[model samples]
Target: MYKKVALAIAFSPTIEALISETKRLVELFGSELILIHIGKKTDELETQLEEIIIKTGLDILNTKLIWKEGKPVHMILEACAEEKADLLIIGALKREGILTYYLGSVGRKLIRKSKCSILTLIDPRVEAERFSKVVVNGTQMEITPKVISKALKFCQIENVSQVHILNEIKLYAFRMATASKGSEDEVSNTRRKLIQDEIVYVQDILKDLDKTGLKINIKITAGKWAVELVRYCEAFKADLLILGDERGYTFIDRLFPHDLEDVLSELPCNLLIIK
Candidate 1:
Protein backbone atom coordinates (compact mmCIF):
# COMPACT_ATOMS: atom_id res chain seq x y z
CA MET A 1 0.00 0.00 0.00
CA TYR A 2 1.12 3.56 -0.69
CA LYS A 3 2.14 5.66 2.29
CA LYS A 4 2.14 9.09 0.67
CA VAL A 5 0.71 10.62 -2.49
CA ALA A 6 2.00 13.87 -4.03
CA LEU A 7 -0.32 15.97 -6.14
CA ALA A 8 1.52 18.50 -8.36
CA ILE A 9 -0.73 21.54 -8.72
CA ALA A 10 0.25 24.19 -11.29
CA PHE A 11 -2.85 26.29 -10.58
CA SER A 12 -4.07 25.66 -14.09
CA PRO A 13 -7.75 25.25 -14.95
CA THR A 14 -7.39 21.64 -13.82
CA ILE A 15 -6.25 22.18 -10.20
CA GLU A 16 -9.66 21.44 -8.78
CA ALA A 17 -9.91 18.32 -10.88
CA LEU A 18 -6.46 17.25 -9.80
CA ILE A 19 -7.42 17.80 -6.19
CA SER A 20 -10.65 15.80 -6.55
CA GLU A 21 -8.88 12.91 -8.19
CA THR A 22 -6.12 13.08 -5.62
CA LYS A 23 -8.78 12.87 -2.94
CA ARG A 24 -10.07 9.66 -4.46
CA LEU A 25 -6.57 8.21 -4.50
CA VAL A 26 -5.88 9.42 -0.98
CA GLU A 27 -9.09 7.89 0.35
CA LEU A 28 -8.35 4.67 -1.46
CA PHE A 29 -4.81 4.20 -0.18
CA GLY A 30 -5.23 6.04 3.11
CA SER A 31 -2.15 8.04 2.19
CA GLU A 32 -1.06 11.60 2.80
CA LEU A 33 -1.56 14.09 -0.04
CA ILE A 34 1.12 16.73 -0.64
CA LEU A 35 0.05 19.60 -2.86
CA ILE A 36 2.95 21.18 -4.77
CA HIS A 37 2.57 24.48 -6.59
CA ILE A 38 5.49 25.89 -8.61
CA GLY A 39 5.89 29.23 -10.34
CA LYS A 40 7.18 32.77 -9.86
CA LYS A 41 6.68 33.87 -6.28
CA THR A 42 4.22 36.57 -5.35
CA ASP A 43 2.57 37.45 -2.04
CA GLU A 44 -0.95 37.31 -3.43
CA LEU A 45 -0.47 33.93 -5.15
CA GLU A 46 -0.03 32.04 -1.91
CA THR A 47 -3.14 33.60 -0.47
CA GLN A 48 -5.01 32.71 -3.64
CA LEU A 49 -3.88 29.10 -3.39
CA GLU A 50 -5.13 28.86 0.15
CA GLU A 51 -8.45 30.33 -0.91
CA ILE A 52 -8.79 27.81 -3.70
CA ILE A 53 -8.17 24.91 -1.36
CA ILE A 54 -10.63 26.17 1.24
CA LYS A 55 -13.33 26.88 -1.33
CA THR A 56 -13.00 23.44 -2.88
CA GLY A 57 -13.92 21.77 0.42
CA LEU A 58 -10.76 19.69 0.27
CA ASP A 59 -9.85 18.05 3.54
CA ILE A 60 -6.83 19.71 5.12
CA LEU A 61 -5.62 16.73 7.15
CA ASN A 62 -2.77 14.81 5.58
CA THR A 63 -2.81 17.51 2.88
CA LYS A 64 0.09 19.96 2.44
CA LEU A 65 0.41 23.04 0.31
CA ILE A 66 3.89 23.96 -0.93
CA TRP A 67 4.82 27.13 -2.77
CA LYS A 68 8.03 27.07 -4.78
CA GLU A 69 9.62 29.25 -7.41
CA GLY A 70 11.39 27.50 -10.29
CA LYS A 71 10.70 25.42 -13.37
CA PRO A 72 7.47 23.51 -12.87
CA VAL A 73 8.82 20.01 -13.42
CA HIS A 74 12.08 20.65 -11.56
CA MET A 75 10.38 22.16 -8.55
CA ILE A 76 7.83 19.37 -8.40
CA LEU A 77 10.60 16.77 -8.47
CA GLU A 78 12.41 18.52 -5.64
CA ALA A 79 9.26 18.56 -3.52
CA CYS A 80 8.57 14.92 -4.24
CA ALA A 81 11.98 13.96 -2.90
CA GLU A 82 11.58 16.26 0.09
CA GLU A 83 8.18 14.78 0.92
CA LYS A 84 9.25 11.24 0.03
CA ALA A 85 5.94 10.63 -1.69
CA ASP A 86 5.12 7.10 -2.69
CA LEU A 87 3.05 8.10 -5.68
CA LEU A 88 2.69 11.27 -7.76
CA ILE A 89 -0.48 12.40 -9.53
CA ILE A 90 -0.68 15.06 -12.20
CA GLY A 91 -3.07 16.28 -14.90
CA ALA A 92 -2.56 15.63 -18.61
CA LEU A 93 -3.74 18.53 -20.75
CA LYS A 94 -4.20 18.80 -24.47
CA ARG A 95 -2.48 21.59 -26.36
CA GLU A 96 -5.01 23.61 -28.35
CA GLY A 97 -7.25 20.57 -28.66
CA ILE A 98 -9.98 18.87 -26.69
CA LEU A 99 -8.25 15.50 -26.76
CA THR A 100 -5.39 14.95 -24.28
CA TYR A 101 -1.82 14.61 -25.48
CA TYR A 102 0.91 13.09 -23.34
CA LEU A 103 3.84 14.96 -24.81
CA GLY A 104 5.47 17.78 -22.81
CA SER A 105 3.23 17.32 -19.78
CA VAL A 106 4.49 17.83 -16.22
CA GLY A 107 2.56 14.68 -15.32
CA ARG A 108 4.54 12.77 -17.90
CA LYS A 109 7.84 14.24 -16.71
CA LEU A 110 7.22 13.33 -13.09
CA ILE A 111 6.00 9.90 -14.15
CA ARG A 112 9.41 9.26 -15.71
CA LYS A 113 11.77 10.76 -13.16
CA SER A 114 10.15 10.30 -9.75
CA LYS A 115 11.64 7.26 -7.99
CA CYS A 116 8.15 6.14 -6.97
CA SER A 117 5.10 4.77 -8.72
CA ILE A 118 3.10 7.36 -10.67
CA LEU A 119 -0.62 7.85 -11.32
CA THR A 120 -1.98 10.16 -14.02
CA LEU A 121 -5.54 11.44 -14.28
CA ILE A 122 -6.29 12.88 -17.72
CA ASP A 123 -8.76 15.23 -16.15
CA PRO A 124 -10.84 15.05 -13.00
CA ARG A 125 -14.08 14.92 -15.00
CA VAL A 126 -12.66 12.44 -17.47
CA GLU A 127 -11.54 10.20 -14.63
CA ALA A 128 -14.91 10.62 -12.94
CA GLU A 129 -16.94 9.82 -16.05
CA ARG A 130 -15.02 6.69 -17.04
CA PHE A 131 -12.66 4.08 -15.70
CA SER A 132 -9.11 3.56 -16.99
CA LYS A 133 -8.36 1.77 -20.25
CA VAL A 134 -4.75 0.51 -20.37
CA VAL A 135 -2.44 -0.67 -23.11
CA VAL A 136 0.80 -2.35 -22.06
CA ASN A 137 3.85 -3.19 -24.11
CA GLY A 138 6.85 -5.48 -23.48
CA THR A 139 5.29 -8.62 -22.00
CA GLN A 140 8.32 -10.88 -22.34
CA MET A 141 8.61 -11.16 -18.58
CA GLU A 142 6.61 -13.48 -16.30
CA ILE A 143 5.65 -10.86 -13.69
CA THR A 144 3.62 -8.45 -15.84
CA PRO A 145 0.17 -9.63 -14.75
CA LYS A 146 0.74 -8.88 -11.09
CA VAL A 147 2.07 -5.41 -11.84
CA ILE A 148 -0.78 -4.65 -14.22
CA SER A 149 -3.36 -5.79 -11.70
CA LYS A 150 -1.95 -3.58 -8.97
CA ALA A 151 -1.79 -0.57 -11.31
CA LEU A 152 -5.35 -1.15 -12.51
CA LYS A 153 -6.58 -1.22 -8.94
CA PHE A 154 -4.76 2.03 -8.22
CA CYS A 155 -6.20 3.74 -11.32
CA GLN A 156 -9.86 3.15 -10.58
CA ILE A 157 -12.16 1.32 -8.21
CA GLU A 158 -13.49 -0.66 -11.18
CA ASN A 159 -11.54 -2.77 -13.61
CA VAL A 160 -10.07 -1.38 -16.80
CA SER A 161 -11.88 -1.81 -20.14
CA GLN A 162 -9.16 -3.50 -22.26
CA VAL A 163 -5.60 -4.49 -21.44
CA HIS A 164 -3.51 -4.75 -24.56
CA ILE A 165 -0.56 -7.11 -24.22
CA LEU A 166 2.11 -6.49 -26.84
CA ASN A 167 5.23 -8.48 -27.61
CA GLU A 168 7.99 -7.93 -30.13
CA ILE A 169 9.17 -10.76 -32.37
CA LYS A 170 12.24 -10.31 -34.51
CA LEU A 171 12.91 -12.73 -37.36
CA TYR A 172 16.15 -13.16 -39.23
CA ALA A 173 16.63 -14.98 -42.56
CA PHE A 174 19.85 -16.85 -43.32
CA ARG A 175 21.53 -16.92 -46.69
CA MET A 176 22.59 -20.09 -48.57
CA ALA A 177 25.86 -21.88 -47.69
CA THR A 178 28.46 -19.28 -48.73
CA ALA A 179 32.02 -18.52 -47.46
CA SER A 180 30.76 -16.81 -44.29
CA LYS A 181 27.53 -18.78 -43.87
CA GLY A 182 26.76 -21.73 -41.60
CA SER A 183 24.37 -24.65 -42.10
CA GLU A 184 20.88 -23.28 -42.91
CA ASP A 185 19.04 -26.06 -41.06
CA GLU A 186 21.14 -25.57 -37.91
CA VAL A 187 20.57 -21.81 -37.82
CA SER A 188 16.87 -22.25 -38.51
CA ASN A 189 16.57 -24.74 -35.64
CA THR A 190 18.29 -22.30 -33.24
CA ARG A 191 16.02 -19.45 -34.30
CA ARG A 192 12.99 -21.68 -33.90
CA LYS A 193 13.98 -22.63 -30.36
CA LEU A 194 14.46 -18.98 -29.33
CA ILE A 195 11.09 -18.08 -30.80
CA GLN A 196 9.54 -20.98 -28.91
CA ASP A 197 11.02 -19.71 -25.67
CA GLU A 198 9.46 -16.30 -26.22
CA ILE A 199 6.12 -17.89 -26.99
CA VAL A 200 6.23 -19.97 -23.82
CA TYR A 201 7.07 -16.91 -21.75
CA VAL A 202 4.10 -15.02 -23.14
CA GLN A 203 1.83 -18.00 -22.52
CA ASP A 204 2.96 -18.22 -18.91
CA ILE A 205 2.02 -14.58 -18.32
CA LEU A 206 -1.40 -15.10 -19.93
CA LYS A 207 -2.05 -18.17 -17.78
CA ASP A 208 -1.37 -16.14 -14.65
CA LEU A 209 -4.04 -13.67 -15.78
CA ASP A 210 -6.56 -16.35 -16.72
CA LYS A 211 -9.16 -15.58 -14.08
CA THR A 212 -8.89 -11.81 -14.23
CA GLY A 213 -12.14 -10.14 -15.37
CA LEU A 214 -10.44 -7.36 -17.30
CA LYS A 215 -10.73 -7.56 -21.08
CA ILE A 216 -7.48 -8.79 -22.67
CA ASN A 217 -6.17 -8.16 -26.14
CA ILE A 218 -2.87 -9.72 -27.20
CA LYS A 219 -0.52 -8.80 -30.05
CA ILE A 220 2.83 -10.12 -31.31
CA THR A 221 4.52 -7.82 -33.75
CA ALA A 222 7.91 -7.47 -35.46
CA GLY A 223 9.77 -4.17 -35.62
CA LYS A 224 11.67 -1.73 -33.44
CA TRP A 225 9.93 -2.75 -30.23
CA ALA A 226 9.23 0.63 -28.69
CA VAL A 227 8.19 2.30 -31.92
CA GLU A 228 5.87 -0.56 -32.77
CA LEU A 229 4.28 -0.44 -29.35
CA VAL A 230 3.70 3.31 -29.61
CA ARG A 231 2.19 2.92 -33.05
CA TYR A 232 -0.05 0.15 -31.82
CA CYS A 233 -1.35 2.40 -29.05
CA GLU A 234 -2.13 5.21 -31.49
CA ALA A 235 -3.92 2.84 -33.84
CA PHE A 236 -6.02 1.33 -31.06
CA LYS A 237 -6.58 4.63 -29.19
CA ALA A 238 -5.46 3.28 -25.82
CA ASP A 239 -6.18 5.53 -22.87
CA LEU A 240 -3.17 4.74 -20.71
CA LEU A 241 0.22 3.31 -21.60
CA ILE A 242 1.08 0.91 -18.77
CA LEU A 243 4.73 -0.04 -18.93
CA GLY A 244 6.80 -2.04 -16.45
CA ASP A 245 9.69 -0.86 -14.25
CA GLU A 246 11.66 -2.17 -11.23
CA ARG A 247 8.75 -3.07 -8.93
CA GLY A 248 7.83 -6.76 -9.20
CA TYR A 249 10.85 -8.20 -10.92
CA THR A 250 14.56 -8.62 -10.28
CA PHE A 251 16.13 -8.57 -13.71
CA ILE A 252 14.29 -5.58 -15.19
CA ASP A 253 17.11 -3.13 -14.65
CA ARG A 254 19.53 -5.19 -16.70
CA LEU A 255 16.99 -5.77 -19.44
CA PHE A 256 16.25 -2.58 -21.34
CA PRO A 257 16.19 -0.31 -18.32
CA HIS A 258 13.70 2.53 -18.94
CA ASP A 259 14.23 6.22 -18.29
CA LEU A 260 10.81 7.59 -17.38
CA GLU A 261 11.87 11.19 -18.05
CA ASP A 262 12.87 10.39 -21.62
CA VAL A 263 9.72 8.37 -22.20
CA LEU A 264 7.53 11.15 -20.78
CA SER A 265 9.16 13.58 -23.15
CA GLU A 266 8.35 11.35 -26.10
CA LEU A 267 5.12 9.41 -25.45
CA PRO A 268 1.93 10.92 -26.86
CA CYS A 269 -0.19 9.68 -23.94
CA ASN A 270 0.07 9.25 -20.18
CA LEU A 271 2.41 6.49 -18.95
CA LEU A 272 1.90 4.26 -15.89
CA ILE A 273 5.17 2.57 -14.97
CA ILE A 274 5.39 0.03 -12.13
CA LYS A 275 8.43 1.16 -10.21
Candidate 2:
Protein backbone atom coordinates (compact mmCIF):
# COMPACT_ATOMS: atom_id res chain seq x y z
CA MET A 1 0.00 0.00 0.00
CA TYR A 2 2.92 2.30 0.69
CA LYS A 3 4.57 3.93 -2.30
CA LYS A 4 7.40 5.92 -0.77
CA VAL A 5 8.63 4.77 2.67
CA ALA A 6 10.71 7.19 4.70
CA LEU A 7 12.69 6.35 7.83
CA ALA A 8 13.87 8.71 10.55
CA ILE A 9 17.55 7.89 10.83
CA ALA A 10 19.65 8.19 13.96
CA PHE A 11 23.16 7.06 14.84
CA SER A 12 21.90 4.90 17.67
CA PRO A 13 22.49 1.18 18.15
CA THR A 14 19.03 0.46 16.79
CA ILE A 15 19.84 2.13 13.48
CA GLU A 16 20.81 -1.10 11.82
CA ALA A 17 17.71 -2.86 12.98
CA LEU A 18 15.56 0.04 11.91
CA ILE A 19 17.15 0.14 8.47
CA SER A 20 16.73 -3.63 8.13
CA GLU A 21 13.04 -3.33 8.91
CA THR A 22 12.74 -0.46 6.46
CA LYS A 23 14.43 -2.51 3.79
CA ARG A 24 11.90 -5.29 4.23
CA LEU A 25 9.03 -2.86 3.97
CA VAL A 26 10.51 -1.15 0.92
CA GLU A 27 10.92 -4.46 -0.87
CA LEU A 28 7.54 -5.67 0.25
CA PHE A 29 5.68 -2.60 -0.97
CA GLY A 30 7.95 -2.00 -3.99
CA SER A 31 8.54 1.44 -2.54
CA GLU A 32 11.38 3.90 -2.72
CA LEU A 33 13.34 4.30 0.51
CA ILE A 34 14.18 7.74 1.84
CA LEU A 35 16.45 7.95 4.87
CA ILE A 36 16.12 11.20 6.80
CA HIS A 37 18.64 12.35 9.38
CA ILE A 38 18.02 15.52 11.37
CA GLY A 39 21.54 16.80 11.85
CA LYS A 40 24.65 17.92 10.03
CA LYS A 41 25.90 15.42 7.51
CA THR A 42 29.59 14.59 7.77
CA ASP A 43 31.93 12.41 5.77
CA GLU A 44 32.22 10.03 8.73
CA LEU A 45 28.45 9.84 9.10
CA GLU A 46 28.01 9.22 5.38
CA THR A 47 30.62 6.46 5.42
CA GLN A 48 28.99 4.79 8.43
CA LEU A 49 25.53 4.95 6.81
CA GLU A 50 26.90 3.48 3.62
CA GLU A 51 28.46 0.59 5.56
CA ILE A 52 25.20 -0.13 7.29
CA ILE A 53 23.30 0.08 4.03
CA ILE A 54 25.63 -2.44 2.47
CA LYS A 55 25.41 -4.73 5.49
CA THR A 56 21.62 -4.55 5.47
CA GLY A 57 21.55 -5.34 1.75
CA LEU A 58 19.48 -2.23 0.97
CA ASP A 59 20.27 -1.05 -2.54
CA ILE A 60 22.45 1.98 -1.88
CA LEU A 61 21.84 3.39 -5.36
CA ASN A 62 18.07 3.20 -4.96
CA THR A 63 17.95 4.74 -1.48
CA LYS A 64 17.80 8.50 -1.04
CA LEU A 65 19.57 10.03 1.99
CA ILE A 66 18.58 13.38 3.41
CA TRP A 67 20.19 15.49 6.14
CA LYS A 68 18.64 18.55 7.70
CA GLU A 69 19.52 20.70 10.73
CA GLY A 70 16.62 21.84 12.81
CA LYS A 71 14.27 20.52 15.51
CA PRO A 72 14.22 16.76 15.23
CA VAL A 73 10.46 16.40 15.01
CA HIS A 74 10.05 19.29 12.62
CA MET A 75 12.87 18.17 10.38
CA ILE A 76 11.66 14.59 10.20
CA LEU A 77 8.07 15.55 9.49
CA GLU A 78 9.17 18.10 6.93
CA ALA A 79 11.31 15.51 5.18
CA CYS A 80 8.42 13.04 5.08
CA ALA A 81 6.15 15.65 3.57
CA GLU A 82 8.75 16.92 1.13
CA GLU A 83 9.33 13.37 -0.04
CA LYS A 84 5.59 12.65 -0.17
CA ALA A 85 6.10 9.53 1.84
CA ASP A 86 3.20 7.13 2.19
CA LEU A 87 4.68 5.57 5.34
CA LEU A 88 7.15 6.74 7.98
CA ILE A 89 9.15 4.33 10.12
CA ILE A 90 10.71 5.08 13.48
CA GLY A 91 12.10 3.15 16.42
CA ALA A 92 10.07 3.58 19.60
CA LEU A 93 10.40 2.70 23.24
CA LYS A 94 7.86 0.51 25.01
CA ARG A 95 7.10 3.30 27.47
CA GLU A 96 7.79 7.01 27.75
CA GLY A 97 7.92 9.30 30.75
CA ILE A 98 4.67 11.02 31.71
CA LEU A 99 6.38 14.36 31.17
CA THR A 100 7.35 13.33 27.63
CA TYR A 101 3.78 12.35 26.91
CA TYR A 102 2.39 15.65 28.17
CA LEU A 103 5.10 17.71 26.54
CA GLY A 104 5.67 15.53 23.43
CA SER A 105 8.55 13.40 22.36
CA VAL A 106 9.59 13.05 18.75
CA GLY A 107 7.74 9.74 18.45
CA ARG A 108 4.54 10.95 20.12
CA LYS A 109 4.53 14.23 18.19
CA LEU A 110 4.95 12.38 14.88
CA ILE A 111 2.22 9.94 15.85
CA ARG A 112 -0.19 12.81 16.44
CA LYS A 113 0.84 15.27 13.76
CA SER A 114 2.25 13.32 10.86
CA LYS A 115 -0.14 13.04 7.92
CA CYS A 116 1.36 9.81 6.63
CA SER A 117 0.90 6.43 8.28
CA ILE A 118 3.49 5.54 10.95
CA LEU A 119 5.09 2.29 12.07
CA THR A 120 6.71 2.29 15.50
CA LEU A 121 9.07 -0.56 16.14
CA ILE A 122 9.59 -1.64 19.71
CA ASP A 123 12.65 -3.78 20.47
CA PRO A 124 13.70 -3.86 16.84
CA ARG A 125 16.17 -6.62 16.02
CA VAL A 126 18.80 -6.93 13.38
CA GLU A 127 17.28 -10.28 12.62
CA ALA A 128 13.77 -9.11 12.09
CA GLU A 129 10.99 -11.66 12.15
CA ARG A 130 7.78 -11.70 10.19
CA PHE A 131 4.59 -10.61 11.93
CA SER A 132 2.75 -13.88 12.28
CA LYS A 133 0.02 -12.83 14.70
CA VAL A 134 -1.60 -9.44 14.25
CA VAL A 135 -4.32 -7.65 16.20
CA VAL A 136 -6.30 -4.98 14.36
CA ASN A 137 -8.63 -2.45 15.97
CA GLY A 138 -12.07 -3.18 14.53
CA THR A 139 -13.92 -0.77 16.78
CA GLN A 140 -16.85 0.74 14.86
CA MET A 141 -15.53 3.95 13.37
CA GLU A 142 -15.63 5.61 9.98
CA ILE A 143 -12.00 4.60 9.28
CA THR A 144 -12.20 1.09 10.70
CA PRO A 145 -13.10 -0.61 7.42
CA LYS A 146 -10.12 0.91 5.67
CA VAL A 147 -7.85 -0.01 8.56
CA ILE A 148 -9.04 -3.62 8.53
CA SER A 149 -8.72 -3.80 4.79
CA LYS A 150 -5.13 -2.58 4.95
CA ALA A 151 -4.37 -4.99 7.77
CA LEU A 152 -5.77 -7.96 5.81
CA LYS A 153 -3.87 -6.99 2.70
CA PHE A 154 -0.66 -6.67 4.73
CA CYS A 155 -1.31 -10.04 6.35
CA GLN A 156 -1.80 -11.64 2.98
CA ILE A 157 1.44 -10.15 1.70
CA GLU A 158 3.35 -11.31 4.77
CA ASN A 159 1.70 -14.74 4.84
CA VAL A 160 0.36 -14.23 8.32
CA SER A 161 -2.16 -16.92 9.16
CA GLN A 162 -3.55 -15.70 12.49
CA VAL A 163 -5.50 -12.43 12.60
CA HIS A 164 -7.73 -11.02 15.32
CA ILE A 165 -10.26 -8.22 14.85
CA LEU A 166 -10.98 -6.65 18.24
CA ASN A 167 -14.18 -4.71 18.85
CA GLU A 168 -15.00 -2.79 22.00
CA ILE A 169 -18.15 -2.05 24.00
CA LYS A 170 -18.08 0.88 26.37
CA LEU A 171 -18.10 -0.17 30.00
CA TYR A 172 -20.90 2.25 30.88
CA ALA A 173 -23.17 0.74 28.27
CA PHE A 174 -22.43 -2.78 29.48
CA ARG A 175 -23.00 -1.75 33.07
CA MET A 176 -26.30 -0.10 32.21
CA ALA A 177 -27.48 -3.22 30.47
CA THR A 178 -26.48 -5.53 33.33
CA ALA A 179 -27.67 -3.22 36.14
CA SER A 180 -31.17 -3.00 34.76
CA LYS A 181 -33.98 -4.20 37.02
CA GLY A 182 -34.26 -7.61 35.44
CA SER A 183 -33.90 -11.26 36.41
CA GLU A 184 -30.43 -12.86 36.51
CA ASP A 185 -31.26 -14.76 33.31
CA GLU A 186 -32.23 -11.50 31.67
CA VAL A 187 -28.91 -9.89 32.64
CA SER A 188 -27.00 -12.85 31.23
CA ASN A 189 -28.98 -12.65 28.01
CA THR A 190 -28.26 -8.93 27.73
CA ARG A 191 -24.54 -9.50 28.11
CA ARG A 192 -24.56 -12.26 25.51
CA LYS A 193 -26.55 -10.14 23.15
CA LEU A 194 -24.12 -7.24 23.45
CA ILE A 195 -21.19 -9.50 22.65
CA GLN A 196 -23.12 -11.05 19.78
CA ASP A 197 -23.86 -7.62 18.37
CA GLU A 198 -20.21 -6.72 18.40
CA ILE A 199 -19.36 -9.94 16.61
CA VAL A 200 -22.02 -9.36 14.01
CA TYR A 201 -20.83 -5.84 13.40
CA VAL A 202 -17.30 -7.05 12.81
CA GLN A 203 -18.54 -9.91 10.62
CA ASP A 204 -20.44 -7.48 8.45
CA ILE A 205 -17.26 -5.51 7.89
CA LEU A 206 -15.35 -8.66 7.04
CA LYS A 207 -17.96 -9.89 4.57
CA ASP A 208 -16.61 -7.58 1.88
CA LEU A 209 -12.94 -8.19 2.71
CA ASP A 210 -10.57 -10.69 1.14
CA LYS A 211 -9.59 -13.02 3.97
CA THR A 212 -8.30 -15.93 1.96
CA GLY A 213 -5.91 -18.35 3.69
CA LEU A 214 -6.21 -16.46 6.93
CA LYS A 215 -7.68 -17.71 10.21
CA ILE A 216 -9.58 -14.71 11.56
CA ASN A 217 -10.89 -14.36 15.09
CA ILE A 218 -13.44 -11.81 16.24
CA LYS A 219 -13.07 -10.67 19.87
CA ILE A 220 -15.39 -8.42 21.86
CA THR A 221 -13.86 -6.48 24.72
CA ALA A 222 -15.65 -4.30 27.28
CA GLY A 223 -14.01 -1.39 29.03
CA LYS A 224 -11.70 1.42 27.93
CA TRP A 225 -10.90 0.78 24.27
CA ALA A 226 -7.20 1.52 24.63
CA VAL A 227 -6.78 -0.55 27.78
CA GLU A 228 -8.61 -3.51 26.28
CA LEU A 229 -6.64 -3.20 23.06
CA VAL A 230 -3.30 -3.34 24.85
CA ARG A 231 -4.43 -6.24 27.02
CA TYR A 232 -5.60 -8.25 24.03
CA CYS A 233 -2.36 -7.74 22.14
CA GLU A 234 -0.29 -8.73 25.14
CA ALA A 235 -2.49 -11.73 25.90
CA PHE A 236 -2.31 -12.95 22.32
CA LYS A 237 1.37 -12.07 21.95
CA ALA A 238 0.55 -10.24 18.78
CA ASP A 239 3.52 -9.29 16.67
CA LEU A 240 1.89 -6.15 15.38
CA LEU A 241 -1.04 -3.97 16.45
CA ILE A 242 -2.82 -1.93 13.78
CA LEU A 243 -5.25 0.86 14.55
CA GLY A 244 -6.93 3.79 12.77
CA ASP A 245 -6.16 7.39 13.71
CA GLU A 246 -8.17 10.23 12.23
CA ARG A 247 -9.32 12.37 15.12
CA GLY A 248 -7.56 15.61 15.87
CA TYR A 249 -6.71 16.23 19.50
CA THR A 250 -7.20 19.47 21.36
CA PHE A 251 -5.92 20.70 24.72
CA ILE A 252 -8.97 19.19 26.39
CA ASP A 253 -8.18 15.87 24.75
CA ARG A 254 -4.68 16.03 26.20
CA LEU A 255 -6.08 16.73 29.66
CA PHE A 256 -8.65 13.98 29.49
CA PRO A 257 -6.20 11.62 27.80
CA HIS A 258 -7.27 10.40 24.38
CA ASP A 259 -7.45 6.67 23.62
CA LEU A 260 -4.41 7.00 21.37
CA GLU A 261 -2.52 8.56 24.27
CA ASP A 262 -2.95 5.35 26.22
CA VAL A 263 -1.59 3.29 23.34
CA LEU A 264 1.28 5.70 22.88
CA SER A 265 2.11 5.75 26.59
CA GLU A 266 2.86 2.07 26.52
CA LEU A 267 3.03 0.36 23.17
CA PRO A 268 1.97 -3.30 23.31
CA CYS A 269 4.04 -4.24 20.31
CA ASN A 270 5.05 -2.94 16.92
CA LEU A 271 2.27 -0.40 16.31
CA LEU A 272 1.04 0.68 12.90
CA ILE A 273 -1.21 3.75 13.06
CA ILE A 274 -3.11 4.07 9.78
CA LYS A 275 -4.04 7.64 9.12
Best by lDDT: 2
Of the candidates shown, which would achieve the greatest TM-score relative to the real structure? Answer: 2
**What C-alpha lDDT do the candidate models reach, one value each?**
0.65, 0.86
- For residue 203, model 1's alpha carbon misses the true position, in angstroms, by 3.5
* lDDT value, residue 87 of candidate 1: 83
How far residue 156's Cα lies from its native spot in candidate 2, in Å, is: 0.7
The TM-score that candidate 1 achieves is 0.70
Q: Please provide, for model 1 over 195-257, each residue's C-alpha lDDT reduced to its tens digit, 9 standing for 90 to 100.
A: 566566656665654335666666777665667667787788766777766533566545443
Show model 1 residue runs off by greater than 4 Å. 40-43, 54-57, 70-74, 97-102, 105-109, 121-127, 141-146, 152-157, 171-199, 206-212, 246-268
lDDT of 2 at 192: 90
Total backbone clashes of candidate 2, pairs 3 or more residues apart or in separate chains: 0
TM-score of each: 0.70, 0.92
